[model samples]
Target: MEKRLTHFSSGSGCGCKIHPAKLEEILKDVRSDVQSFPNLLVGNEASDDASVLKINDEWALVQTVDFFTPIVDDPYVFGQIAAANALSDVYAMGGKPLMANALLCWPVEELPAEQASKVLEGAKSVCDKASIPLAGGHSINIKEIAFGLSVTGTVHPQKILKNTGAVVGDVLFLTKPLGTGILSTALKRGKLNENGYEALLRVATELNTIGAELVAINGVHAVTDVTGFGLYGHLIEMCKASEVSAEVYFDKVPKIAEAVQYIQEFILPDNTFRNWNSYAQFIDCPLPETFAWLNDPQTNGGLLFAVAEHAVDTLLNTFQKHGTTQFLLEPIGRILPKDEKIIYVKR
Candidate 1:
C-alpha cells in the first residue's frame, strides 16, 4: 500500500467533515436503538460532550473519550493538544477530571514506537499538570498516527452542565478565538502568518483548566467546548437541547485577526463547505460569503459557555482573575424564546 501523503485536506479536525444534517441522520438510527437509563444525565439523545452517570445522589461521573490523527507536525505538541482536547469534553460538561486512559493508534512499520511513547509522555505531562493521572491506556498498530485519552471526571449532581441548559436571555461567551481550522490549514499550505500560526498552537496546547474551574465556580449555565463541529454546529445543539432560539452577532465573534483575509484569498480547508452544508438549517440570518469559510472546524479549541445574562460581567471578571484576560470573550448570541427553531446569525 502506498503511504498516505499528507495534504491540506480536511479542515482543522473531525468537526469540519461533520455536517449537521449527517449527524442528525446517524443519531436518528442510534437514538432509536438505545434505551434510556434513568441514571444517565446526558447521552446520545442530545449531542452533549460527555456522559454523566450517577455515582451517588450527590455526585456524578463524567466520562468522555476522543482520538484523532496528527493535526500538527511536532510529536510532543501533538500529544499535548490531543490530551487537552480529549479532557476538554469533561470540562465542557463542568467536571473535574480524575484519571485518564491513553488511546493510541500508530503505524509501527512507518513510525517508531519510541516516538509514540514520547507522544504518550507528552500527554502524561498535560494530565499531570491538571492533577489527573494517566492511569492506563490502549494502543494498536494502524495506518495513521492518532492519540487522545478517555478521561473520567466528577461533578456535583446538581452542577452537571449540558448543552441543553442554556436559558432564555442567557449570554453566550467563547473563551478562545475562532480560526484554528483556517490557521492550521494555512500552515499545511505554507500560507499562515506568524501570529495566526502562534495563535493556533497556543490555544490548542493550552488546557481548559481555567474554563472548567469557572464553570464550577457558579453562574455558568450550559457548556460545550468547540471541537470537530464548528461553533454553530455545537451552539445549535445547545439551543435545541435547551429548547431555545438564538441570535448570534457575527461581528462579535472572535476570529484570528488574519483568518478573514485568508478566507478572502480563498484559502480554505475542505471541511468548511461540509460544515456549512450540514448545519445551515437552524441559521436564518444573512452570512457573509466568507462566513462559511471562517466557521471551519477546530481541534483542541476553547470552552463555549452560556451564562445567565446578569452573570456575563461576572464570568469575564472571573476569567480575568484567572489570567485569561486576553481570552477574546464575546457575546456572540443570546438565548431566545423556546419553540422558535431558528439560529439567527447576523452582522
Candidate 2:
C-alpha cells in the first residue's frame, strides 16, 4: 500500500504558493486606486487574473508577472514549469503574448550561475514555442531560488475577456484536470508512482497557448486560470465580479485519474486549506467530503471558461480541430441568477 504523506520533500508548481491570507496581510497596507485609470479593463479592486491597459480604442495591452521558488528538484523542469505558469496569465485574459522578460532570484554564492542559465533557457524554449521573443529581463541575488516571466500580450479592446463578465445561463468549462498539487506533493515525498509523476510533469510543463487560441475563436464570456487560490477561490472571484452565482456538479469536475486514490492516501498540499479558508464565505458546498479536493491549489492548471450555450458546440468543435481534444470539456455548472451570490457547490 502506498503511504500518503502530508509534506513533500520538494515543492512543485503553485503548491509552493504563499497562503492568500498571509499574502493579503503583506499587501494590506499598500494602496492602489483603480478609479484613476479610465482605459484599464482589469486591475486591483476586481481581483482580476491579469492587468490590462488600453493602448488605443481597438487594442488593449495585457501585462502580468509571476515568480516563485524551485518547486521541483530538476533545474530544467523547474524552469519550464515556472515559464509556463507565468505565461498562463496572459492566456487567461484571452490574449496572445508578444514579449516576455525573465524574472530571476538566485543565490550568487551558493548555486552556480549556470543553473540559472538553464532556467532561462527553459523559459526561452517555451517562449519560442509560442512564437514570442525573450526580449530582456532583470535578475537579482536572493536567499533562495526563484524564476518566472513578466509577459506582455495584446488583445482587441472589444474582445478582452474579464473574470467579471459571466452572465446567467452560461455554461462553465474546465480545459484540464486538477491534481497537479497532489501529484507534486507525492513527488516531493518520493512516494509518487513513476507514470503519475511523469504525467503531471508533461501537463504542467505544457503551455496554455492552445487553450488561449480556443478562447479567441470561441467568444467566451468569462475566463480565468486556476492558480494559488485554487478552483473554488477563483470561482468565488468570478461569481462576485460578475454578480452571478454558480452551481458546480462535483462529479463533473475533472481530476487526474490517480488523484482520487492519492486523496484517500492523504497526499495533499499544505496550501489547500489556506485556499479554502480565504474564500469559504462565498462557497456554499453541501458536501463536506469534497472540501479538500475542490480547494487543492493547482500550479499550471487549466483554463475555466464560461461560454454561451449557443456557442458551446462551436467552441468545442474548434478546440478539437486545433488538437485540444485532450482538454476535458465537462459542464460542471451554470451561471445562476445574479441574486444568489457567488458560488453554490452541489452534490
Candidate 3:
C-alpha cells in the first residue's frame, strides 16, 4: 500500500509553526544578550530571517534552522520543499548557502525506513542544485514524520540584508504568488489537481536567489522571505523593526490560480485562523476573506522585498534580465511612514 506522508501529520509544511504571538511570548523571557557580542550583526532583537555573525571585516556567517511536517504526499517532494524552505532563510539575508544538516523525525512504527531514505535523497538533490553539502544531522522516532534542514551560508558584511531597513516611500515587491497554504490544504483534502500540485512544487522548490542578487542594488533596503507567518505577519514584523507602515493593494497581489479556486471553496489550513488571530489587531483589511491570502501560512514562499522608489524600475529590469517572469515580480504595495496602523490594505 502507498502511504500518504501528509496523512500522518497534523499540520502541513511551515503551517506547523507555532502561532507568532505564542512564539513571541515564549521567547520573551529567554535572555539573549546579543549586544554582548558586537560580531552578532543580526540577532533575535528583530524578527529577521537568520542570525548573522561577523567572521571578519568583509564576511559574515548566516545561520538558520527550519523543519516541518510533510505538505505533499510524496516523500521526495516533501524533502525538496523542506530543504528549499530551510535554505531560503540564508538567501533571504542575501547570503549563499555553503552547507546544511538534515533534521528528521520519523514514525518508525507507522512508516517504513525506505520512505525516510527517499526523503533524504530528495534533500540531497536540492542541496546539490544549491551547490551545498548536506554535512550531517540527527534523527529520532516521533509520532509525526517531519523533516527540514539547518542551513549555513556566507555574505559580505557590507551587503548583508535585514528586514529592519525598510524606509518610507520604498516599494514592496513579492517574488512569487501567494496561496501555497491554501493549495496544500486542498491537497490534504484530495481536492487539488495534478497541475496544482505541480505548481506548488515548482514554486516552493525554486530557491529565492534573487535576494542575493538584490544586494548589488543599493536601493534594496529590506528583504524577507514570506513563510509560515504569511505576508501580513512578516510585513508587520518588518514594519515594527523599521518603524514604518505599509500600504498594500489587495487586487494587485499575485496568487496561484488553483489557490484562488480552493480559497473560494473555503479550503484552508488550520493556521489560517491562528495566523490572523496572532496579528489581525495590527492589520486593517476591510474584507475578512482577504486574510485567506494575507495571513495564509506559506511553506517555501517568495521574498518580500522593499526597494527605493527611484530604483523600482531598475529592480524590475534586473528581474527581467534574469529571466524572471513579470507574474513573479508583482508590485503589491509600498511602505509608508509609521502610523497608528502597521498595515493598510487597499481593496
Candidate 4:
C-alpha cells in the first residue's frame, strides 16, 4: 500500500507556518543582542531571506533554516520540496550552499520507518544537486512528519543581495508561477488531477540556483524567495525594507492554469486568509478573486528579483544565454515611488 505522507499532518507544507501577523506580534517585544555584532551583515531587523555574517573582506557566510510538513502524498517528493524550499533562502541571498543539516520530526509510532528513510533520501538527492553535503542534523519523535534543512552558504561580500535593496523604478520578476498552495489544497481534497499534481511537484522541486547568477548582474538590486508569506506579503516586506512602493500588474503575473480553476471552485488553503489578513491594509486589489493568489502561501515557490528598468532586456538576454527558459523570467510588475499604499495591484 502507498503511504500518503500528508495524512499524518493536520496542516501541510508551508501552510503550517504561523500567521505573519501573529508572528509579528510574537516577535514585537523580543530583542536579540546579535544585532550588536558588527560582523553581522544581515540580521532579523531587515526581515531578509538569510542572515549573512562577514567572514572577511572577500567572503561572507549565509545562514538560513526552513522546514515544513508534507504537502504531497509521496514522502520523496515532500522531502525534495522541503529541501528546495530551505535551499532557496541561500539562493535568494545570492549565495551558493556549501553544507546542510537535516531537521526532521517523525511520528515513529504512526508512520513506518521506511517512509522516513525515503524522505531523507529525497532530501539527500536535492542536496547532491545543489552540490552540498548533508553533514548532520537533529531529529525528534513528534506527532507529525516534518522535514527541512538548515543550510549554510557563502558569497562574496559585495555580491550579497537583500530584499531591502530594491529601488524605485526597478522591475520585478518571479521565477516560478504562483498557486502551489492552491494546488496543494486541491491535492488534500483529492480534487487535483494527475497533470496538476505533476505540475505541482515539478515547480515545487525546482531549485532557485539562478539567484546566484543574478547577483553578478549589476542591475539586480534586490532578491527574495516567495514562501509562506505569499507574493504580496513578501513584496510588501521588500517595499517596507526598501522604503518604496510597487505596482503589480495582476494580469502579467504567472500562475498555474489548474490553480485558477481550483480558485474558481473555491478550493483554497487556510493560509490564504491568514496571509491576506496579515497585510491586507497595505494592499489595494481591484478584484476580490485576486486575493486567492495574491496572498496564497507557497511552499518551495520562486525567486522574486528586482532589477533596474533599463537592465530588463539585458537581464533577459543573460537568462537566455544561461539556458533559463522564457517562462521562468516573466516580469510581473515594477517598483514604484513610495505611496500611501505599499502595493497597488492593477487588474
On TM-score, the leading prediction is: 3
Position 61, candidate 4: lDDT: 97
Tell me the TM-score of model 1. 0.90
Residues 34-134, candidate 4: write the lDDT tens digits.
75698888888878889999999999999999999889988888889989999999999999999999999998888888888888899999999999998
> What are the clashing pairs of model 2?
9-188, 11-71
**Can you rank all candidates by lDDT, best first?**
3, 4, 2, 1
Candidate 3 C-alpha lDDT tens digits along 94-213:
999999999999998889999999999999999999999999999999988899999999999999999999989999989888899998999999999988898898788988888778
Error of 1 at 247 (Å): 1.1
Off by over 4 Å in 3: none
Clash pairs, model 3 backbone? none
Comparing 2 and 4 on TM-score, the stronger one: 4
Q: Which regions of candidate 2 are displaced past 4 Å?
A: 1-12, 22-34, 214-219, 339-341
TM-score, one value per model: 0.90, 0.90, 0.97, 0.97
lDDT of 2 by residue, 1-347 (tens): 32111222234567666676676677686534557777877776667767889989978999999877666666777788888999999988888899999988777776777777888888888888889998999998876667889999998888777788898999998877788888877777677887777878877887887546655555478888887777898787788888888998888888788776778889888788777777787778779867766898888888887889988888878768766655375687888986544788786
Candidate that would win on lDDT: 3
- lDDT (Cα atoms) of all candidates against the true structure: 0.76, 0.78, 0.90, 0.89
- Candidate 2 has an lDDT of 0.78
CA RMSD, predictions in order: 2.9, 3.7, 1.2, 1.4
